[model samples]
Target: MWENKIDINQIVEIRAKTTAFFGVGAIKKMADVAKNLSSRGIKKVIVMTGKSSHIKTGAWAVTKQALEANAIEYLLYSEVTPNPTVEQVDEAAARAKSFGAQAVIAIGGGSPIDAAKSVAILISYPEKNASELYELKFAPDTAVPLVAINLTHGTGTEVDRFAVVSIPAKEYKPAIAYDCIYPLYAIDDPALMTKLPAEQTLYVSVDAINHVVEASTTIVTNPFAILLAKETIRLVAKYLPVAVKEPENLTARYYLLYASLIAGTSFDNGLLHFTHALEHPLSAVKPELAHGLGLSMLLPAVVKEIYPASGEVLAEIFEPILPGFKGTADEADKAFAGIRNWLDGIGVTSSLKDEGFDEYMVDRLVDLAFETPSLDGLLAIAPVKATREAVRNIYTNSL
Candidate 1:
């Protein structure tokens, strides 16, 4: 797929920045990694964690022990909220700066880790707030070195260089990406995920599959993204049901973790199209809607709208995973139908109406989606240009 994009000797960067340490007992290595980063003058570390499961699972206790073992002083911020806001990041950065933090450790899921990355960036600009860092006028800055002890099997933020934050005042939730924001390393321990409830597994697995399919079908896809995406699709289809039905299955948890990481890397390279672009506002406006639920409600609609561009291609890819799927005259629609059926089979039944969206919210959602630059940006790069009518139709159809 990438052969035509480059010359024989030209170079292109393809993988994520963070090196993942996969499997059980990975957290034990956190102390060693922190000590190594400290050799470069890092002393005090800011650890981004939440007040919930990190305490119950003993992840933070281990982290505290690690830091103390390394003779490192640390500050703990447990206030990271889901769909982290710019205000939270700015607050965390201020606290980190006050502690004179030299490095950062994000323990738990994507929300805290995403906040930590932003905190890492804002640490250097004590004179500026985190909101300023996302603005075009502010020059891009490097982040303090960061590491991740990821607890969830979703939101591959652990291995990727993107941080998403909601700006309530602006009605925007945009993913902020730059070179310096990637984690220095990731500890991906499936054991940490064994206690996740079945519903949580389903929500996150839906999120993973969305990343894979959207990346593969997007207009700007590269060879690396395609390979990673194809494998991700297969992995999620095979393992997600197991994860949902048997949350404590170590093998299922391991494979699901791998799928999320692969999907994250693929999307990092290929980027997302209308699904993510449209899905963000559903949560930004509702606040209570989980991101994965929003994606479940919105992705099929976007997929149905865009299928004509690569329907048969998608049909072939999903054939093995989708039961009783066969190419038809309307193969694209069939492909989408197969996906919808698969979602139903796995117990996902989210929709705009079922999720509390009404006719009045349609215009509001569209406008909010447009507020995200990526929506219009994706239209520019999409195989089918999302006309004003098309964009409106995508939202309305989902309703």
Candidate 2:
């Protein structure tokens, strides 16, 4: 199905460095990743994370072991918030410098990993200003190697070479992108996710589902991307709930992990459309909300808006995956309906009001969405070109 996009002879240059170091659990592979670095004579290690407690996990434990074994000479820990800020990245970079770290290890969900990527850039390019990197207008002069131990499935922070950093009081967040931002190694172990609370597990899985759905639906005219998207949607529908309900279900967890990886690959190539373009501003304003939760709330509404523009395309693509909707109209309706049902089934379909966002914020959010960089990317593939008014309408509808 994806044969067209699969070019056998074409020299496709994937610039980022990525190594999937899968293990039964995070800790087992942590030692292996560190050993790989040690073999390369990497001594000083800077560990960037959101919280100190993450260190107790298998990934952190293995890192500690490496430290004791002298495989790691020094460690700098940056315990920042979920949506990391530019200031946090600068602080982490300073700490890494002070520690004389040679490599960076990020252990957490997206924020820490994203921040680590930025910090690595700052470490390698000390003379370059941070704001300049955020524009991503040019390649970095230098960037340190990063190894990520992913604790969450949705963000795909370990594989993508892009870092989102919040700019305080700004309408749009900035991204740092370079070949260097990609993790030299990515450790995805379901065992680490088993300990997450049920609510968090569900939210993260839903986020991954949304990623696949959004990416697949956006460029429906593209046959190869559509097939990949349909397969991902099927996997998410089949396994997200099981993984959410029973955290210890290794099979379910593994499926979710693979789903996230596939979703990341799709978006990495095709780019996320409206859902992400709108969701980012909301997270920036509501610092208290999880990125996954914010995405869940906005996804259904975004899907509804895009349906009119891309309904037929979506119906054809989703027909194979969701057989319950066999007829044309039935398939089209169910494609969007399935998403709402999934969100409701998992108990993540909270209104913006429930999440403490009021109608008054609609104007501000619309303004922010207009300023987002990926708007062109969203408009190019979105069922419709989302205008300022359309964005405002979606925000109002979400409320």
Candidate 3:
């Protein structure tokens, strides 16, 4: 029933700026990675992660052992939380700077890895604070090497050069893309992702879906983006439910992880538009909101808005779940219904209202969508113009 099948037992190496080692038991290679870093004169490192997922999944043990075996000094910075803040990045960077960290080992999902990217920048240029770096006060041309140990199949931070951080006081959540922030090494072990909670498994895959959706629809989209977008949708539509139902199913986890990896590459090449631009404000206003959940809540509305402009591409990519969807601009409502049904099928039945938002917040979210730094650039790449009225309508419709 599957096409172009992947062998679950085969470990694969993917080389890019970040040389990724992927498969079950891939975390075991951390010792070799550490030795390589040591050979490059990286003597001291800072290990970044969220509160406990790494430890729970046992990835942390392998990493700690590897560092010790290589005689590398390390500091564990575990205070990273969802919607990582500028303050947290600054604090971690400062600590790493004082400790003389020569590299960073980020051991969790997007949040920790994203934070580590910024921390790496600060480590290289100790004179800059997180705000200066995030605000693009100066373009950083270099950073300490980052080794990403991915624990979730979302965000694709391990492979992409994007990192998002929030400033709650200002209601600003912005992304930074720079060549220097790419990881020097990455590990995507499905074995480590097996223990992820059901909600997170759903949310993360939804995030990957949004990644490819906007990626392929953007004005800068290319053939590579379209190809990866279709495959990402197919893999997630088939395997997300399996992974959510059987969290310990390594095969499901492996394919879902592959979906995210390719989705990352897709967006990195194609760029993104309204969905991400709009979703950042939602998560920025409510720091407790998971980034993927926020994206899920806004996806259908954003897709509905863009379907008219990119109907043919979207209909083709979403056909795995949408079935006989006709690629017609006049059938935009059908496309919207198809996407909403797929979301419902995956246990994402919540909306902005379900998530405690109401009409009063629409104007504020719309304002933030445009006012946030770097978001305007994302909005500019949309197939349709992201006017204030359009942004407001998207928010109200999500509610």
User: Considering every candidate listed, which one attains the maximal lDDT?
Assistant: 3
Q: Is candidate 1 or candidate 2 better by TM-score?
A: 1
TM-score for each prediction? Answer: 0.92, 0.87, 0.98
Q: Could you tell me the TM-score of candidate 3?
A: 0.98
lDDT tens digits, residues 179-234, model 1?
A: 78888888887778888887778888888878877777788888787787777777
Question: Candidate 1 regions off by >4 Å?
Answer: 1-15, 323-329
Tens digits of per-residue lDDT for model 2 on 1-399? 342343222212232358765535545656666777888888888988767647555667776776657557757575779888777888788888888888888888888889888888888887654555664545785678888888877777788876788876565565555676788988777667767777777777667766665766665435555666666666667777787677787767766766676666666665667777778888888777788888888876776677666565555544534454433443434555676676787677688899989999998888777675544556567667778877877787778
Per-residue alpha-carbon lDDT of candidate 3 for residues 1-399, written as tens digits (9 for 90 to 100): 563386776778986667889988899989899999999998999999999998999999999999999999999999999999999999999899889999999999999999999999999888888887777788898999999999999888899899999987899999999999889889999999988899999999999999999999999999999999999999999999999899999999999998999999999999999989998988988888888888998888888898889989988999898888777888777777777888898899889999889999898898899888899999999999989999988888889
Q: Rank the candidates by TM-score, best first.
A: 3, 1, 2
Candidate with more favorable, higher lDDT: 2 or 3:
3
Give the per-residue Cα lDDT of candidate 3 at 56: 96
TM-score of 2: 0.87
Predictions ranked by lDDT, top down? Answer: 3, 1, 2
Which 10-residue span in candidate 2 carries the lowest summed lDDT?
7-16
Worst 10 residues of 1 by lDDT: 6-15
